[model samples]
Target: AAALEAYDGHERVWCGRDEERGLVALVGIHNTALGPALGGTRVWPHESFEAGMTDVLRLSRGMTYKAAVAGLPFGGGKAVIIADPKKDKTEALLEAYAEMLVALDGQYYTGEDVGLTLADADFIRERAPNISGTSKGGSGNPSPVTAEGVFLGLKAALAHKSGSDRLAGVLVAVQGLGSVGWSLCEKLHAEGAELVVADIDTDAVDRAANTFGARMADAGDILFVEADILAPCALGGLFSSDTIPQLKAGIIAGAANNQLARHEDARLLMERGILYAPDYVINAGGLMNVAAELAPGGYNREATMRKVTEIPRTLTAIFQKADAEKRPTNEVASDIAMARIADKRS
Candidate 1:
C-alpha cells in the first residue's frame, strides 16, 4: 500500500479488520524514542484502505515531529478507522475500535482527530484505558488548547513581520468554522482583530458572524481573501501548488497539520513573501495538553496552559533559523524535530 510506503524508519504499522463490526483500521507508530506513541484517532470515508493508510502514515509521522517539537515525553502514532463518522459511527463500532487500541497494550494512545470528537473519545475510554481526552480527568477538549497555541504563534508571526504582536486592527481570514476555528476566532475577536471566516456549514458561518462579528466568506474564497494573516483551522494540503499563488495573507499560520500539499510548497510560500509558521511547531498545543495527563502527579491545567505559552519562543527560534539559513520554515522545523528524535534515539 502507498501508505505503508512511508517507512522512513517508522517503528511499526498494524492493520486490523473486523468483519462483524464492518471496520478497517490502520495504526502507524512513527517513533517511540521519547516514550510510548500518543496520537488521535481519525474516522473518515476514505476512498480505499490504501488511502486511509496513507492518511494515517502522514498524520502519525506528523505527530512524531509534533510531539518532538513540543518537547513532550511521548512519541508519535496515529490510527484511522474507515467509516463515515456521520453515518457509520455507533457505540458498538467505537467500542470495537477501542478494543483494537487496547490490544496494543498502551503502545498507542489515541484521543480524537478529525471526524471524531471528545465525546467519541469518551466512548473509547469507556472501553479501554489506552485512550485519553475523556470528559473526566482528561483533556476535555483540544480545540481550545490548539486555538491558544495558534493565537500565540500568530502573535509571533505578526511580531516578526510588523514588529508588533497586537492583533487590534489586524485582518485575519480564518478558514473552517469547526471547534478549533471557532475558538481561534474568539481569541482573535477578543483582541480586536477583524475576522473573515469561511466554512461549508452555514450554521457555523452564521454562528461566527453573529457571535464574533466575523464577516462571512465562502470556503472557496477564504484562502484568497485579503488579510494580514490566514488561519487555516481545517484540513491539510490547502496550500498546494494550485492555491499557493492565490494566498494573499502576509503570514500563514494555523492549526492544520501538513498544510503544504507537497514539501516544496513551503519554498513557494517563502518565495511569495508569505511568512509560514511551521504547522507542527505552532500547533503542538493539543498534543502537549494530552501528554500532560501522563505527568508524574497528574494533569495540571495551569501548567499545561503555561507550557503552551512557550510555543511562541519555539516559533521565533524557527523563524530566525530559517531566515538565517535562507531555507523554508517547514524544512527547518522538520530538521529541529528530527534532531530531537535522533538525540533521544542516540
Candidate 2:
C-alpha cells in the first residue's frame, strides 16, 4: 500500500521477488486505453527498492505518453529489474523474471532497455512469449531505429530554433555512446556535424573520436559543453533547476527518458531559450519498432521506417504549437498526448 501511494493513477504495478534466484523486479502498467501495455524491461543497479519503484513509475508513465504521441496502438508500461546486469544477471534470475511476465497474462509486453541486449531478450523469450526485440522472431535490436527517430526529431528542433535544419558545421555534444548513442553519432557524422562526445566506456569514446573525428569530453563536463546542441543519450533526471542555468546548448534533444527532474524544469528550459524535444515524443522509435512485431502480418521494416519518419513532423507540430502558446514543448507535447488518450477513452 505504501508503494501504491507513489504510483498515483497507474493502472497496475507488479512487484516480484525470488530471493533464492536473486530476482527482484517491478512492472508498472500505467495505462491500457489504447491497447495492452507495451514497453521495455530495464535492468539497472538501483540503490534500493524505493529507488527502483520511483524509476519504474516515472518510466512507465512516460511510456504511456510515448505510445499516445507516436500514434501507436498500444498503452504505456515498463519493467525494472533491481540489480547490476554485469555482476548479477544470470539464467536463473532471467527465468524467475520470465515467470513474472507469464503471470501478467498479456497485460504487458516487454522488450529490452538499458543494461539489456538482444541476447537477453532472446533468453527471456525462451520462457515467456510476451516479449519483443528477440533475435529470432522479434524486431531485433531497436537502437538504430531509435537513433533514426532522434536524429529526425533533432533536425526538427534545429529547424524550429533556426531557419535551417542542416547539420553541416553544427557542433553537437553527445553525452553517451551506448548502442543508440553510437548509432546517432554515425547519423550525425554522416550529416557533417562536428561531434563532442563523452562516455564512461573509454573504448566507445575512443572509437567515436577516431571514427567521427569527435573531441572527447569528460562525462561530467559534457552537459555544460559550449555546443550548438546537447544530446543526452544517457540516463534521466539530468535537467533540473541547477543544471538548466548551466546549460550552454541552445537545444536539448536526445534519446534519454525523463530528462527533466520535474515538470517545472520545462519552463526553466523555456525561460533559458533552450529548445527541448520532449524525450518520450522523440524516443518512440524503439517502441514503434517493437510494436511492429505485434502487427497482424508481423514486423515490416519498411512500414516501421515509414512510421519513424513521421517523428519529425510530430515534433514540428509540437514546436509550432508551443511557440504559438508561448509554452514549453514538454507541456504542449504532454497535453497533446493526454488529449489523444482521452479521446480514445471517450
Candidate 3:
C-alpha cells in the first residue's frame, strides 16, 4: 500500500463496497491534472476479486491517459462492480453502490460502461450525484458514438495494416453484438466487409447473423475464427499468449479498452506481424464526443468527426515511431500520455 501511489501503478486497488447489498466496486483514478477524475462504471460477473481489481485499476489509468491524449478536460477514473448482469442487478444493489460513490464526494464521477446502461446509471445517480452518461432528456445512447469511433479506427487499421484503404472484401470477425458491436458491424457490413460474428447472447448472435447474413460461431470460437480483422467489442485481455497462438487474423481493432492480457502483449502482437490498434486510442472517440456534449451548444458533428478520425493518425505515428526506434508501440504511446498526466509524490 505504501508503495502504490500512481493510479496506473496499482494492480490491485481498493474501491469501497456496499456489503449490505452485496455490491463490490473497484474505482481506478488515473489522474486529476485536468480536473476531478471521470470514468464509467462497468458491471460484470467477475470470477474473482483479483480479476476485478486488475481490470478496474488498469482501465481507470487508461481513462486518465485516454482523456489526456484526446485533450479532454476530465481526468481518468473507472469503476467496476462484481456481479453477473443477467443474474444480479437489483435496484437495492445499485442504490447501495450509489451510496458508496456518493461518499466519495466529487473526487470521482461515473458514466456508463460495458454492462451498465444509461438507465442503470440514472438509478445510481438517484443516490449518488457523481454519475454521468444518462438520458438527461436528449443524450440518447452512447453506443452510437462509441461505434462511430470504432468504425473510424477500423478504417484506419485496415488502411495502415492491410495496405488497403478499402474493406470491401475484408473478412472481419466480431466477438460481440451489443450496442457498440452491433453498430460497428453495421458500418463494416455497409462498407461491404464480410463478417463472422459471435456472442454469448443467443438473441444477439441470431439477430446479427440473420439480419446481415453473417457466419456465426460458438461463443468461445469467436477468438479462433480465421479472418482479416478481429474486433473485440466485448471485454479486455483476450489477447493472451495462449489465444494469440490461435489467431490467424492480420489486425485487431475494436472498441474495447485495455485489450492486452498484460501491457507487454502489445509488443507480442507486433512480433507476430499483427498490427494492433491501441484500444484506448481508437475507443477514445466516444468519450471525446461525450465530453463535447458537456460543453456549450453540445457537440459539433463535423468537428468531432475530424477529431475522432485522428485516432488512426495517432496510431500510425506511434507505429512509425516504434519502428524507427525499434521499441514497442505501447511504450511510446504510454510515454506520450504519461508526460501529460500530473506528477504526484507521496
Candidate 4:
C-alpha cells in the first residue's frame, strides 16, 4: 500500500503486460511542463509490481529534476520492466514493451538504462520510433558522458570543500565497475587520484586494480572505506540512516540515481559533515546526451558536451546555496529544479 501511495503528482502512469511474451513494465511520466517525457527504460528483477512501481515513480521524479536542473527542454519520465535483464530479456519481449511506448503516442521517449543496452535501444526504436540512445541514429552510449559529468561534479565538490579542484593525491573509493563507473575511474586515474575500487564482479575489480593501480575493497566494505570521496556508481538508496553513520568518506559524488534512501538522509549526511552532490544533478549527462537526438538539427556530440560541462557550475551554485542556508544539498537542488519547473508552467 505504501508503494502504491508513493505518487508525487505524476502527469501520467501506465502499466502494461504481455504474459505470453513475458513482458511486464511500468512507465511513469512525472512532468511535461518543459516538453515531452524523456528517460531510459530499466530492466530490473524487482520483487513485485509494487516494487517496480515505487522505483519508477521515484526515478521519473528524479529525471524531472535532473532535466530541469540541467536546463534541458524536456520533461522527466522512466520505465521499468519487472524481469531479470540477463535471463528474461528477448526481442519479442522488447517488442512488446515497444508496443506499449507506441501506445503512448510519442508523449514518452525511451532509451537505455540499468539493464538495457544500445542493441536493446535499437530494437525498441525500430518498433516504437520514439526511442533514443540507439547505436544507429541516436547517441550510441551515454555512460562515458555521464562519467565525465560525475568527474567534473566531483572536482567541483572537491573545490567547494577544500578550495581546489585538483584530483592528484585524492583517494576516491568507487563502488560499481559498470560502464559509467569504469569510465569515471579512468578519468580519475588520469587526474592522478588514488582509487579504492569495489564491485560484485570480481573481474571488474581485478581489472581496475591492474589498470588504475587501484586498491581493492570488498564490495560491502567500499562504502565505509577511509577515502576522501565515495562514489556510489552502483544501485540507489545507499545513503540512509543505517549507513550514513558508517560512511568514512567526507564527500559523496556518484552517477547512481536516487542515492539517498529518503529525503531526510540528506540532512543526516549533512550532520555527519559529508558533502553530497545530488545524484540526479550529477548523473544527468547521459540524459542530456541522449535528449540531443531530439534537437532541431539532431544529436551533436560537441553541443551535448558543451552543455554537459555546465554540470559543475550548477553544482557550485547549489553548494554555495546549501552552505549559505545550512540545508542539505539535495533539498537545495530540488528547490531550484522545482522553481524552474514552476516558472515554466506559469
Question: Is 2 or 3 the stronger prediction by lDDT?
Answer: 2
**By TM-score, how accurate is candidate 1?**
0.97
Whole-model Cα lDDT of every candidate shown, in order:
0.88, 0.93, 0.79, 0.93
RMSD of 4: 1.1
lDDT (Cα, tens digit) per residue for candidate 3, span 36-96: 6777889898788777877787788888778877777888888889988777878877887
Question: Any runs in candidate 4 off by more than 4 Å, and if so which?
Answer: none
Collision pairs in model 3:
64-76
* Model 1: colliding residue pairs: none
TM-scores for the candidates = 0.97, 0.98, 0.90, 0.98
lDDT of 1 by residue, 133-166 (tens): 7887787878789899999999999999999999
lDDT of 3 at 194: 96
How many angstroms is residue 85 displaced in model 2 relative to the true structure, after the best TM-score fit?
1.0
TM-score of 2: 0.98
Stretches of candidate 3 above 4 Å error?
1-7, 10-14, 296-303, 342-346
The residue-level lDDT of candidate 2 at 83 comes to 90
In candidate 2, stretches whose alpha carbon ends up further than 4 angstroms from where it belongs are 1-6
Query: Over the stretch 1-346, how does candidate 4's per-residue lDDT look in tens digits?
Result: 7465568899889999999999999999999998899998999999988899999999999899999999889999999999999999988899899999999999998888899988888888888888988898788889999999999999999999999999999999999999899999999999999999999999999999999999999998999999999999988979888999999999999999999888778999998899999999999999999889888999999999999899999999999999999999999999989999999988
Q: Is candidate 1 or candidate 3 better by TM-score?
A: 1
